[model samples]
Target: MRKQLINPPQIYDGSPFGMSQAVIDRASATVYISGQVDWDANRQVSCHNVAGQLKKALANLTTVLEASGSSEESLLSLRVYVRGELGEFIGDIAPILAQYLGESRPSLTGIGVSSLAYPEILVEIEATAALK
Candidate 1:
């Protein structure tokens, strides 16, 4: 399938990291969004708390989805990677997820990791969605 890369100006550019923010499969009308971290335009993790980082990451993810011609409701699955204990932050995470996803209950998975791409990053979210 032919692919199209999407890099919205609103989010941190991932090209320097050898990745695009999202890729669209023209033939299948599907979008694969790269893992979005709580990075500012300067590629710095400004949030010190998990909740704050998660909020920024989700916002970045939304920007990618929109740039890919998809919406939150079109999400097919989400893979969340957390830097620390998943249980320690579930309470802070659940509400943010609900705010972005609303009633759309797509497949979701949470994985706890020792660390993320950046030492300060607490969360990263990647998603797959059908084009709207």
Candidate 2:
């Protein structure tokens, strides 16, 4: 299990997360996935908005998981990156995570940046899954 944490009350007050103050993991098999974006088969970013990008990125993440004989339930952590509009991205992606993860909200980190490798790509997601 891997968990995310942002320490100090001053940093987490009013924050939507409940991480402790450390990130730790103990698993048998760990799968690390590269950052995923909203790229289509043609290798083109298919979305200009955070919501669309998140959907596609999640889809890609699932594909990778399936190929590894694992599922979302095996996930131990996720790192999300968004270029601008952090609030909107959170609103769009959090519900999806809630729906897919059920009661197990894996440790996660969200980073807001100014841009991505692809101009049309609004968000990127990477994951770590533990098969145990």
Candidate 3:
């Protein structure tokens, strides 16, 4: 897949916090990753709190990206849904997110919702990526 990750020189980069100004995908294959939660291989929620769930969700996202032949670099955009405010947890996710995405930090949008598909789900992540 072919793509361009653009960040204007005039604007301060937001990658360290997991964000980007724009992503251009000229690839032939585009993958729309469904929202991933903290469910383990047994199909049970693995995390009870926001911090735990955040980590689990990132791990789950990695699995999906690998299965689709698209890695974090291929990611063009991400939508994060959170059940409630996670004051300190946001701080924790930043570094982990930087590590997770490596050199690529796709555009991100964080949404706060009253509830999610599952009540136990403290966080859910959906992503879009392009690949051959």
Candidate 4:
């Protein structure tokens, strides 16, 4: 199955932020990944800062996506929850997410929350992907 991105000239580009305005997936199964934080198997938030935590969270999310027979290209959307403003890190994080997501740019929503599940956790990312 293929995921189709819909973005006409009337709308602005969203790829820089690792998102698209509209995404249509044709996979038979849909995978809902829980909010993935920087916590390891030991249930510890080893990453102390947003930059570090964001990297780990993305990696964790990627593992789940792959395990589900889905890839970043099969992703439908990502809801990002950050402890603080997401603007400052967009320049840094967007590129990394783009690299991870490759050519397929899925829809995304970013929200700034007061805190996450743990004190040391600065960001949590949840994803929805399509699987065959």
For TM-score, the strongest prediction is: 1
Go through the candidates in order and give the C-alpha RMSD of each one to the true structure.
1.2, 11.9, 11.6, 11.7
lDDT of 1: 0.89
lDDT tens digits by residue: candidate 2, 36-127: 67866455766777878888888777766665556788888888999986775677778876886776578989899898866788888878
Which residue pairs in model 3 clash with each other?
A: none
Best by lDDT: 1
Pairs in clash, predicted candidate 4: none
Give the Cα lDDT of each candidate.
0.89, 0.68, 0.71, 0.71
* Local error of candidate 4 at residue 78 (angstroms): 0.7
lDDT of 1 by residue, 1-132 (tens): 398999998888788889999999999999999999988788888789988988899889888888888999999999989987899889989888988888778899989899888788889999999999
lDDT of 4 by residue, 1-107 (tens): 47655433323344665754344455546676667778665557766777788888887776666556677788888888888888867876777777777878899
Write model 3 residue lDDT over 1-132, tens digit each, in one string: 375554434333436647443344555577666677787744488669776887888877776666566778888888888887645467766676778778888998877788997688888888888874
Worst 10 residues of 2 by lDDT: 5-14
TM-score of predicted model 2?
Answer: 0.73
Deviation in Å, model 3, residue 86 alpha carbon: 5.7
